[model samples]
Target: MKILLVGEYNRTHWNLKRGLQTLGHEVLVIGFRDGFKKVDIDIEIKDPLSSRFLKKVRVLIYKFFKIDLLAHSVKKQILSKKDELSGYDVIQLVNESPFLIDLKCQLEILKWLINWNDKTFLLSTGPDYVSVMHAYNKKFRYSILTPYFEGKITNKNFQHVLSYFSPEHKKIHAYLTKTIEGIISNDLDYHIPLIDHPNYLGMIPHAIELSQLHYKTPNLDNKIVIFHGINSKNYYKKGNDIFEQALDLISVRHKNKIEIITVTDLKYVDFIKSFDKAHILLDQVYAYDQGFNALEAMAKGKVVFTGAEQEWLEHYNLEEDSVAINALPDAQNIADKLEWLILNPNKIIEISKNARAFVETHHDHINCAQHYLKKWST
Candidate 1:
C-alpha cells in the first residue's frame, strides 16, 4: 500500500511511517520537515514556507482574527500535488489541528483533501476544529460571553462542549462519531467508541525511535531519579506541580536516595540521558498513564509511575512485571508509593523489569505498526 501521512513527522508520525514501511508499504509524510531523515521509508514532502516567522505571524493573525494559515498551506499543497496524491492507496492526516490550535485550518485542509481523493482518511489524533475553537476562545472571558449578546450563534455558543475542548460525555461521543472515520487516540477513555472504529489506533508522542532504539540498562545502585513537572513554560496540562508536591513529601525521608529533575531547562538529548540512570519516572496526572516521555522511560526499563485505575491500565494492558508502577494522582498516594519504593528497592527492580517487558509487548514500534497496517488494509 502506498500511504501518505499528512502532518508533522515527529516521534508519533515517524514511528507510524516506519511501521508502515517495515510492512512493505510505501509511506510518505507531508509536513514541516524538522530535520528528520530515514533511508528506506519517509519521503519528505517538505513545505517550503513552513518557517518559524510564518508560524508566529499565522498565530498572531489567528489571535487577532482567527486567520488560519496552516489550512491554507494544506489546501495549496493538496492542489499542487493532486496528481501525486492520486497514486496512494491511503492518505492519513495525523494530529495537527488541536495541538496547533488551528483546527479551522485543518478542517479547510480536510475539505481540500476530500476533494483530492475519496479514500483520504482524516486520522484524528486529537480533538476536532469546533472543539478546539471552543477551548481557545473560551479561555478568555470576553470571548466566552461574546456568544450571549450575539443571538443564535451556533459555533460560538457557550454550551456544554467537551470531547475535543472539554471532557468526555455522551454528546461528545456522538459529535466525534460524525467527524472522522477512525481515531488514533492518545488515551482510550477520552475518545470512547470512536477508538473502536475499524481503523482506530493508539499513539505515543515520543519519537518512534524510543520504541525501536536499543538502550543498555545499568545495575541499580540506589540512584532514584524522578522526572516530574512539565516543560513549565509550555502547556498547562502537564500537571508539573502535582509531581513537585510528591517530590517535596519524599524529600523529608529519602533526600539522599532520591534526585528530582525537570527537563524544562535541559537540552533534549541531555535530558533523556539524565533519565538513563534514573530508576523511577512519574508519567503525569489528569490523564491515563502512558505518553511519549513516560513510554520512553518505560522503554528504558525504568519504573514508571503511571495511573492507578482499572480503566486506564486496561487500555494498554501494560505488563505487570515491567518497570511500570501505579499511583493515584493525589499527593498522598504518590508520596506513599515513592516512600515504599525508597525502602523497598527490590520492588523497584521488579517494577523496572515489568516496565521494559510492558513497553516491548505493547508500545514497541514494530508491534504498533503491524496493528496500524492491519487496520489500514481493511
Candidate 2:
C-alpha cells in the first residue's frame, strides 16, 4: 500500500514510517523537515515566515488588509502540496498542521483531497488543546505546580477563580470528534468520545525496544549514573527544579556513589548514547506515564523509577513496588528509592529483567507498525 504521512516527522514519526516500510508499504512523509531528513524519509518543507522583521511587517500589513488572509496563506501552501497528495492508498495527517487550525478551511481542503481520491484517512495524534493555549498565553507566569498538572486550569490563585475557567475553550474537547476518522493519544486519559468508532484506536503506553545494538549491563564498580532531563525551553513541563532537588538530596548522602548528567546540553544522538552509563533512569514522577527517555532506559536493560499510577503500573504488569520503583515528586521519596536500590543488588536485577521484557513486547517498532497496518486494513 502507498501511504503519505504529514507532520513534523519527529522520532515517533520516523520510527512509525520506517516500520511501515518494513511491512512492505510505501510510506512518504511531507512536512517541516526539522533536521529529521538524515533518518530516511521523503520530506516537503513548509516553514512559515518567522523572522522578527517579517513578523513585524506582517502585523503592520494586516492592519491595512485583513487578519483572515494570514490563515489563507497557509491554505494556499497546503493546496500547492496537493500534487504529491495523489496516488496514495492512505494519507494520514498526523497532527494539526498550520492549515488545520482554520476549521472551515481545513474541512474544505479535506473535501477537496477526498474528491481527488476517496482512499484517505485523517488520523490526529493528540488534541493537546489546553497545552497549546497555555503555551501561547503570556500571563500566569506559566508555572506548573506539579509534574502532574496534566489537569487544565488558568491559575490556582486569581481574582475570580471560577470565572477564569473557559467552558467555550474547554468545548475544544468536541473538536477531537469533529471530522477525524481515528485518534491516537499518548495519554490514556485524554478522553476522546470516539473510542467506540470502528476506526477508533486507543493509546499505547510508552516503552523502549531493544535497539540494533543491545545495551550492556552496568559494572556496579562506578557510581550510579542518573540522566536528569532538564530542558531550558520546557522547564515547566520537565519539572527542572524537582529534578534539581532530587539531585541535591542524592548528593548529601551518596555524593561519591552517584553521577548526575543532563541531556539538554548534548546532541540528540549523544544524549541517547549517555544512557549507556546509567544504572537507573528516573522518570518524571508527575507525568501520568513514562516518556521517551524513561522507555529508552528500559530498552537498555536498566531499572527505571516512575509514578505509581494504577493504569501505568498495569500497562507493565507490575504491582506496587515491583517492576518500577514508584516515587512521588518529593525529594525525600526519590532519594529513599534510590538509596534502597543502591543497597539491594538483587532487586535491581529482577526489575531490570522485567523492564527489558516489557519493552520488547510492547514498543518494538515492527510490532507497533504491524498494529497500525491492521488498523488500516480493517
Give RMSD to native, each candidate: 7.5, 6.1
Candidate that scores best on TM-score: 2
Give per-residue lDDT, candidate 1, residue 322. 40
Model 2 has an lDDT value of 0.58
Clashing pairs in 2: none
Error of 1 at 33 (Å): 6.3
- Could you tell me which residue pairs clash in candidate 1? 11-207, 321-354, 322-351, 322-353, 322-354, 322-355, 323-351, 323-352, 323-354, 323-355
Give each model a TM-score. 0.72, 0.74
| Alpha-carbon deviation at 47 in model 1, angstroms | 9.0
Error of 1 at 86 (Å): 4.1
Model 1 has a clash total of 10
- Local error of candidate 1 at 223, Å? 3.2
lDDT per residue (tens digit) for residues 153-261 in model 2 = 3343321222213453334334434544565554433322334555456664432235653756566776777767554534544555666787788789888877887
